[model samples]
Target: MSALDIFENDSDDTKSAIMRATYHALCEHGYANLTIQRIGDEFAKSKSLLYHHYDSKDELLVDFLEFVLEKFKADIPAEEYDDPCAHLREVLDHVVPPTLDAERYEFTSAMIELRAQAPHDEAYREQFSRNDRFFRQQFADVVRDGVETGAFRDVDPEQAAALLVTTINGSMLERVTTDDAEDAIRATRRELDAYIDSHLLAESGE
Candidate 1:
C-alpha cells in the first residue's frame, strides 16, 4: 500500500485529514517552501483547525512524521512470511522497489528533504534515528531467524543488517537526487541480490 493510505484508516478523522493534507502540501511545495497556508489549501476543514493544533509548520510536521512512523510500523507484515528469505526479499523490495512511479518518486523526494534537515533539527533527527533503529532491528531479526533455520550462512546478523540498511539508505538518496536514478536503482537491486546470494543464503537452502 502507498504510505499515504495509512491516513485513510486513521481513528482520528481530523488528525488524519490534516496529515494527508500536509503530505500533499509537502509534495507540491517541498520542504523548503511549505507553509501552513499551503497545507490549509489542501485541507477540507477550516484553516483555523490547523492553527488550533499546531502553532508552527514545523510543529505540525513533527507530529506528521510521528504519525507516518506509527502507521509504517503497522503496515509491515514481517511476521506473515514463513520463509526468512522471502521476508528479507520483501523488505528489500519495499526499500528499493523495482520501479519508481510519479507518486512514489514525489513522496520519496519529499521524505529525503525532511531527512536532510535531521542534522540541524533535533526533533527530525530523533524521529529519523528511531526509524533507522526500527529498520535495522527488523533486518537483524530476519537474519537471525534465517541463521537459526539454516536458511542462511552463519553471519553476524547485526553487521549484515547494518550494511543492508546503509546501502538501502544511500540508494534512496541517490534515487531522489541524481538524474540517473533508474540506472542507480537497477544497479542497487543487482548488487543487493548478489550480496544475498554470496553472503546470506546457505548453499543447501539456495
Candidate 2:
C-alpha cells in the first residue's frame, strides 16, 4: 500500500471524518485555496461539526498536520530483517520515493504548500518542526543500526540522515513544481542509491 493508506480507517470517528474531509479539500483546492468551508463541503452530512470544533481553517489544518504525522508514524513497519541494510533500504524505499501514486502526489503537494506557510505561522512552524525532527531521527536510527550491526560502513548517522531528508525534500519540491516530475523523481532515486552505495554501504557487501 502507498503511504497515504496509513491514514485510513482511523478509530476516532470525529477526527477520522475531519481528516478525511481535510484530505479531500487539500487535494482539490490546495493549501493556498483551502478553507474550512471547502473541507465542510466534503463532510456534507455534518458540516456544522467542523465549524463547532474549529473556528479557523488554520487551526484545523494544524490539527490535520498532527493527525497525519501520527498516522505516518504508526504505519512504519517495525519488523527487523536478517539484514539491517536491507531493512534500511526498505525504509528509504517507502520514505523517500516521490509520489508512487496519485494520492501520494496530491498529499505531498499539499504538504509543501502548507510548509510554505510555516515561516509566518507559529503553530504551523511548531508542528512541521516536530514532524521534521521525528523523521530525521528515524532516518538516523536506521543508519546507526546499520553501522552497529555490521551492515554498513562507519558513517555519521545524523549527517547521512540529513542528507537523505534534504534530498527527498528537494526532489519532492521539484516534483510538484515541474511537468516532468516522474523523470525528476526517478533521477532522484538513482542519485540517492548511488550516494548510499558510495558513503554508507560497506564495499564488500555490495
Candidate 3:
C-alpha cells in the first residue's frame, strides 16, 4: 500500500463529498441555516443519504470543523528547520497574517461562528476545543524538540507555543473589524518577534 492507501477508499470519498457539501452550505448560509435539507440539496442527494453519513446537525458541525482543521494542518507548510526559533519564524510567515487568502478568511469566520455558538451547544465546544488542542500540539512538538537541542534558546516552550497560536487567533479577530488587516498584521508580526526574543532567547547561548 502506498502512503495514501489508508485514506484511499470509495467510502472515504462519499463521506468527503457529504462533508464538502455541508461546508459549502455552512459558508453560504451560516451555521443556523445549515440543515440536513440544505446539504442534501447542495449535493443533489436525498436527506436520508446525507443523514446516513452524519447523524445530526451537531455531528455535521463537528465533522465540518474537523475537516477545516485537517485542511489547515495540510496548508501550513513545515518550516523545515532544526532551530525552534527559526522554524517558528517560518510559521510566523503564515500565522500572523496580513497575507492570508480568502480560504483562510473563510476558515476564520467559521471558527468564530463556532466559538460564538459553543455556549449553547456543549458538544460543539468540547469537540472544537479538542480539535484545537490537537492542532496546537503540532507546534509544541517542534518547539520542544528545538529547545532540547542547541538550536533554540532555553525557555518555556509551552508559553512560546501558546503565544504563537494565540497571536494567530487574535489577529483573525482583529482582521474582521480593521480597515487594513495587512498593515495591522505586519505591525503585530514585528511585535511578536520581539516578544519571542525577550522571553525565549538565551543570554549566553546560541
Candidate 4:
C-alpha cells in the first residue's frame, strides 16, 4: 500500500511519493550537493520513474518546495485554539523549532539552505515570496482578530506581525550556527512572551 493510496488518489500518491523522496534527498544532501540520483535512493520506485516526471533536479526540487510549503500552510492550527491570543502564540511556536530533534534540525537546515538560493533563482524567489506573504498575512489576521475580540490591545497588526516573523527567522539563522540552540530558542520564546504581554494583552496584575 502506497502512502498516497492512504489519500485514495493515485496521481496524488505518485506526486507525494516523489516529494517525499525529494525531501529525503534534500535532508540527506544539502541543496549544494542534491541530485536526482540521490533522491531516487529515497524513492520507493525506480529512478527512471522520477526522470520520466522531471527532466532535472532543479525542476523536481522546485516542485518539491511548493509541495512542502503547501503542507506547511495547511498544517497551521486554524481553529484549534480557544482564543486568538492562544492561536497567535501557537502560530509563533510553530515557526520556531521547539525541540532539538535531529530530524527536525536536518529538515530545517535543508529548508534554510534552499531559502538562501532565493536571490539567484527566480522560481525559488517567487515561492519564498509567496510563503513570506502568506505568513505575514496570517499573523496580521490573527492579531486583528484578537484586537477586534478584545483579547488583545489595539496595535498595528502589520508591524506586530513583521516583528514576530522576523524574530522567528532570526532565531532559525542563529540555530544554524550553534551546536546547542536550546538557550537561544528559550530566550526568543521569553522575549516573545514579554512582547505579547506588554504590547498585545492588557495589564492584569492585581
Highest TM-score scorer: 1
Clashes of 1: 0
Cα error of candidate 2 at position 136, Å: 0.7
Better of 2 and 4 by lDDT: 2
How would you encode candidate 1's per-residue C-alpha lDDT over 1-206 as one tens digit per residue? 35656766666589888999998898888889999999999999999999899998888888888888888888876445568888888778877885777767888888899999889999999988988888889889999989998989899999999998898889889988889887878888888889898889899735
TM-score per candidate, in order? 0.93, 0.91, 0.77, 0.87
**Between which residue pairs do clashes occur in model 2?**
none
Error of 2 at 101 (Å): 3.1
The parts of candidate 2 lying over 4 Å away from their true place are 1-3
Which model is ahead, 3 or 4, in terms of TM-score? 4
Measured with C-alpha atoms, the lDDT of residue 143 in candidate 2 is 88
Task: Give the C-alpha miss distance for residue 76 in model 3, angstroms.
Answer: 7.2
Report the lDDT tens digits of candidate 4 across residue range 26-140.
8678888998989999888877899999988878878977776677665554564558777877666766755646656777788788888889999988887887787788889
- lDDT of candidates 1 onward, in order: 0.85, 0.82, 0.68, 0.76
- What is the RMSD of candidate 2? 2.1
User: Ranking by TM-score, best first?
Assistant: 1, 2, 4, 3
lDDT tens digits, residue span 56-101, model 2: 9999999999988888887777776677667666766776665557
Per-prediction count of colliding residue pairs?
0, 0, 0, 0
The candidate, 1 or 4, that scores higher on TM-score is 1
- Cα lDDT of candidate 4 equals 0.76
What TM value does model 4 have? 0.87
Which digits, one per residue and each the tens of the lDDT, describe model 3 over residues 1-206? 11122222324466677776776676677666668788787775556877777778878887776665665665555556656677778667755645656655665666677778888888788877876586478678877786777555776667776777788777877775567877988998999888767766555444
